[model samples]
Target: MENEQKTYRIDGFSCANCAKTFEKNVKNIKSVENAEVNFGASKITITGDATVQQIEKAGAFEKLKVVDKNQPKPEKQSFFKKHREVLISGLFMLLGFALIIINDGQNAITTGTFLISIIIGGYQMFWTGINNLSKLRFDMKTLMTIAVIGAALIGEWPEAAVVVVLFAVSESLERYSMEKARASIQSLMEIAPNTAVIKTPAGNKELPVEDVRIGDIMIIKPGDKLSMDGVIQSGSTNINQAAITGEALPAPKSAGDDVFAGTLNQSGYLEVEVTKNNEDTTLAKIIQLVEEAQQERAPAQHFVDQFAKYYTPAIMVAALLVAIIPPLLFGASWATWVYQGLAVLVVGCPCALVISTPIAIVSAIGNAANRGVLIKGGVYLETIGQSRTIAFDKTGTLTEGHPHVTDFMTYGDYDREAVLALSAALESKSEHPLAASILDFTESEDVEYSTIHIDDFKAETGKGITGTIDCKIYSIGKPENFDDADAYQSEGKTVMIIKENNTVIGLFAVIDPLRESSKAAIEKLHKMGSRTAMLTGDNEKTAGAIAGTLGIDTVYAGLMPEDKLDAIKNMQSDHKVTMVGDGINDAPALATADIGIAMGKGTDTALETADVALMGNDISQLPFTVNLSKRTLRIIKANITFSLVIKLIALLLVIPGWLTLWIAILSDIGATLIVALNGMRLLRVKE
Candidate 1:
């Protein structure tokens, strides 16, 4: 049998500690090689000989059900069916309290009613405690059951009933908090419709998204949400991609342009040729990646996990000493000390501390995805918050990547047409961005150009290209390859030198305009105290001029692809660097930097290689992303501090026997609710 890796969705998997317990138990199984439980996503991924039966068995103690990822989870039981026992137990507790108030502690009926509440509310905890105690597994259920039984043994029936009711309420609130955190991710799934209108052999027909095939033509009317990824075959319209890319303005789309599923078509009728099925759509990929990002552990989350592992056991020992030492050694009153110890047990649960980091991370990642920012994981999100320096590629990053021909002059006996005709023919053979500008210029000028069969075509990165255009070899490159080229360089233009038979023929000056938002974004980064630099293959004059216009702090010009990587690595020694680019040449530097941010409109290689992707290729979102990261970190720290301080204060009360059952449970459960709400603040952060 071959080893296989499978992922299963888990239902009823809210407790963070229970997730760890399930992972540990699954790893201990003989056939399993490794197991990882993602609590935020409620999933378990395992690689080895593991079976669904084995996975279910590991989670049986927590009532967690393991099922296939694609399988519809068993329908959630109705509220009445699921919480019937909880309702009955609460009624019993109410009756018990009323009886005590009516009888004034003298009637047998009061004691009996209180006993009934204890039996109804405390039975499940006691059962779970016995099973766990037999296996030597200590958990919250075990601690609670022990505390309740000890209080009942010392003749404090009312206090025991109070403990049972409060613990049940605490569990309910914890489940509610987890469900609220998961709601943001679930909202993403509801954005796209389940059906689409596709053109069939007979006519236009409505079909389920799963039945829609690649190459099928989809008709999208104005106000309809797109149901599949495809390229426009005809018509023009504006698309609202705010759901996917977070670009606030409606982007105009024309013939042959790509549109993503779940985006709204705002104007004109569009006929699209489908390129991807429902599962492979960009919207689907974003949802899947966002869910996984929430599961990835950050450093603070890991620390809390380690802390809980020891914290629970140490608190159990402390409660035991409080109960036994005062009664046996100091001759303290047994009932009073025992009740205080039971209160300590209620306050010691690690519920708030464990969930503090993950809830904040999940909220931040989901929010970023909605705005068209894709943050891969919590670690990368946190790293971007700490980055001290950011290096940017000049073309397509700081400036509009498209360039236009400014001035062209023939140096030899050749006229403008003869030189440009040969230049356009040679440039047509290449796919570089500059080649497109040359082709556009020739078409605009109506130069009668003829295609020539070029032999031995070659290219030099950061320089230019060469090919055979006529009987003589022709070369098109930078101004440095020719003599007396200082005029164009001094004008801050990228001058392409044309040479044939070792003689200079012509010089073409071109300039790519800077992006409108570059200066504002750079100024914002500066205000945030982050240094910025520009790395480019353009000559020093051109690169320096563009950098100066945008107020960039440093410029590294005349660089090859490898040279850009070296520049990033050199900067890494002094400060954490963020490389931003949108081309194949920018891939190395993007990967070499401490954090890589890629423009959304950049090449697919650059997008995949980058740590963070700006879907609209807008520089304005850069400062917003950095500010969001910083805010997420601050919120996480606040949650952790608040949880610890509340617990510290509750624990101090136990020293003077001042704590009561209600106050102790409130301390633990209240902190949990407050921290959860605090972490959710990141979801409302605006881009």
Candidate 2:
């Protein structure tokens, strides 16, 4: 999450205006949690669940990539920067002391030094308070601004100078703490790789990835960052997509495999046909999502954001009460309360509450990323914990997308390879997962395949293939394609029986087996007071069997994309529906559900569509992260309430003259320290 107070580089930063403009630009990005542009360095680090697509659409950066390279870092002001204003005022105080030693307080040196110090430190307060007073904004700043000026007007210049300088120091410390809390979020820039070598027809040309565009042919050497989203057109390679999808195994790819923009090309050379425009590439989409996530406030966290808005103004009125009512009521000195009020005002800023929740969120997101999960934003974190319904894509999500031989009903004593080989020969040129799987299995056994009339063959979405073989009507498809009365499956996927001439052959079965941890995950979620359901495009038997085995509460099988979404909407009233899937076809359901949990190693579109990507294909972490979110929300609420209570108590004590400057400082700042320390506990959260 981008923390507004967090430091980031302002590209080509020339002055204060540039910093402000860059900050504003970054903030305008939908999911940008916060944008703090340091004018010193020409770089921008944006934090959020903003994907590259949104950013490219927003057009914020003419060209902005995260900057964490070992360039010579710029040197900011030393520890003495915040103390400079105080140092000048202190010099005046010392001058006044010299004058006092010579001829007493009435001397010109003493008078001049006192006047100078007061003017230097109290001017900002005077005008700011006047501004606030004009707005009918009876705030702490208004009271202190008037009080400090009054102190100087009455010849208490030294005291006035000390007050403002102290306030300045406290503000400085608050800023520093904020900087520390936002450190981890800055690491998000690493999501974009620095370089890319585009492949032109002439040869491989090395260029920065920023210059890449859509439809450009690119050659990837061994161990190269995939610079743009494209499909592999040539060469065989095993790519490590772990960073993008969190899978441990290297997926083998040949021609026609789509690779994402930010992933790694692990082994072998490859030529890719760019499928996505450069601006709308996968990497860009990730950045955009992160940014959006950061800007989106969690329901529980919003309380803190609003708390600071009122707390500051109320403290001002309380300060006035300390100055006015206390003197009138108890005949106590007005000066005492005035000083305490100033201290209260300084401590009352909502810096602590503002910093707490977002830090935890950013830390949690980072932690998830390290383990291969991509939680787009805090709002998703909030919803994930409450989601009760789980929708899944049959292939790649529950069952492996890679096809398998599920049945081999012998017809007239046909050999195993007899049907397998014939089907493989027909599907040898097909690109569908089941087709590829059949071909892979048959080819592995060195079964000879004779070319068939694949040109006439057509792939039916969610079903199977259809074509003529040897002048005989042949259809190889899901069991659902055949009459339900004619073919039936017990639990898992079953291939249908179709005749090449007349008599029926046998059925072949395949399944994308349940994720190794899915059953355990479902059980854990059930115990956590969440009802678990399954949504699939499989037949009644396969879906039902998987549901029963995993102890799922409900099952929706043989559903279309739209039907899945509509079913999710039906469950929306009483529960948050979490759709977990791993196919491009599941995109709509993923988008429609309360939480779109995408399997990381799924397709690029699925990865982008999902709200939370289970990075390693392990469904167990899904439940763990949800539980973590709930726990985090509780801690955040505690931090906010605790912070507010301390400040409120201190405010009461300040007006009644019961609390002094030291106690006020301790109360206001101590709560902040406590809140910040509590947020750091997120780093220790067990993943």
Candidate 3:
């Protein structure tokens, strides 16, 4: 049988290190050819004939769970059920302390209560620890279990009970913090409606989204959330697309306009024909991409993971040495050294450090996705943080892309209308982009022109066109092909010359205008210390005019696709370059740059090829994305540093005999909470 890959969501998968260990064990199973565990998303994927039973067996050592990805999540437990052991352990600890205070540490009840707390709180840890210890797999749980058991063996019952109770609380808080970090992504799942009203031949019928097929007409009322991607067939409305594209204002949608799933129809009643099914909707793609992006670890995260693999065992050795060497060689007090060893074990868990980078990455990516930007991975997000040079593609990126007739000049009393009509009549037969723009302009102006048959029509690729109308030969070519080309070229406009029997009749100057946001976005990039450049295939005059208008720092004009790619590479030699394009002709440059950002309106090839995508084709979001990335990286660094500093302080305390079991556990828990909350701050980043 061919090996098929299956993904399963693993319940109770809180520890990143434990997930790594589980993946290794699962991969060892005879039926499994490969296994990958995504600690951030709590998912495991396996290839070959690996059954859930085999997966469960692999993770059974740590009490990890394996469930099919298609299965709905189990119902949440009540508060008591969720933290039964912790609450029970806490009560026992309190009773023990109370008895100790009441009886002055002399009663059997005090000792019994402490012993009960240790048994209740530490049993789960003890079982898993012993299992892993037997297999020589030492982890945080194993360290805590040893600390508690060793303290008890030395007659420190109260201390052991306190360690057990505190450890339980720490585990609970860690799980809660991770859940908080993941909540951003979980919220995205609720955006799309589960049921949609479909228009049938007889009437409209409400059906599950899965049952809705392509080409089905959907009837949407005011305030109805769109259930699938479709085009408006009739009626007009304003749609709140903030959920998908993050456009702040509701977009006005009319006939033939496309509406995405998960956006609300805010104003009017409408009928839309579904263009895609539920699974293929834009909202579905965003969710999947966001989840997958979170799963790919960052460079810093990989380093921490590799460091942690050895960190635990090394700590174990150090703790053992601290317990035995001082007592044996230095003749130090056995109890003192042993207590210090237990403290070291408590400080060695690595929970905060393991999670420091991933939490920030997940939060930043989720926040970016929610704000109409899709960053593909942590590495690219990090790359954006360090970028210093931004190179923009001129047409369709920095400019409106649709050229218009800016100036029309007529010679010898020939009216502008006459020249325009003749040019439109000749250009109507062409399928060029410029031709479409001309047709649109003429149609919008309601220009009247006679359609006359022209024979012997010929188009030159770089110069212009030639045709014979009514036995009269007319040539329309570049301004340089006529006499007044430089005057139009000086104004940064593309000039076309029209002649009657080889005598110049008139000229038209067409130009693609700058986008409204181009100037502001470039200014923001410059303020952020990014040098801006415009790369275009247009003439130097046109490119320079745009660069001057937009205040771009540099310009590379008259370049082909290959030249653009080469320019990107040359720029990368000194500075980290970011290339922004519509993602079609700029494919090679986008690939060659350190990072590529594609506009949402670009072709699918562009969106697929670029590292980041700006939805709604808004360049204004680019500066915000850069700031967000920098902020995210800063937070991640702060988290890692904070974790290390806390651990370092705790370790130093072992020298002064000031590190207590409760203090050690609290420090680790405190660092974990701080980092998680700090990472979650990314969700609130704004312009």
Clashes of 3: 0
lDDT (tens digit, per residue) of candidate 1 on 614-661? 877788889988988888889888988888899889989988889887
TM-score of 2: 0.71
Query: Taking the tens digit of each residue's C-alpha lDDT, what string does model 3 give over 1-687?
Result: 679998887877666766777898899998888988877677888898777778888888556787653557778999999889889988999988888888787467787898898888888789878877898988888898899888888787888888888878777776776677677776777888888999988898999998999999999999999999999999999999988777889999999999988999999999999999898888888877777888767788878878888999999998898888888998999998998898899888898998788878878888888888888888888999798899999878888878887777889977777667777777876654467666666677788765667788887654567888889887776655354666666676777778989788987778887889999999988888889988987667767777888999989987867889999988988889999998776888998999999888412453477999887788988999999988988998898899989998998998777888778888988887888789888878996
Ranking by TM-score: 1, 3, 2
- Once fitted onto the true fold, the runs of candidate 1 whose alpha carbons sit more than 4 angstroms away are 24-34, 46-95, 106-127, 469-471, 481-492, 602-607
List, residue by residue over 1-687, the lDDT tens digit for candidate 2. Answer: 334332333322222222343456567777687655432123345666555455333323222334334464456667666457657766776677677777755665677777787667556556646765776754434545665665655565655665565544444454454444334434434654656677787878876666777777888888887877888889888887766665667888889988877677778889998777655775565554655565566776566546655766676666666567766897877776556655566556455555567656655665565456777778888788767666666677765566666555646766766677677766775676667666766777788767555446776766666666666666676554455423335556545554455455656566566667777887888878888777776678877777888788888887766888888888887878888877366777788888888876535555567788875676767777777777777777788788777777876775445765456545655676676667667656664
Order the candidate numbers by lDDT, best to worst: 3, 1, 2
lDDT, candidates in the order shown? 0.82, 0.64, 0.83
Ten residues in sequence with the least summed lDDT for candidate 2: 10-19
- Can you give the lDDT of residue 630 in candidate 1? 86
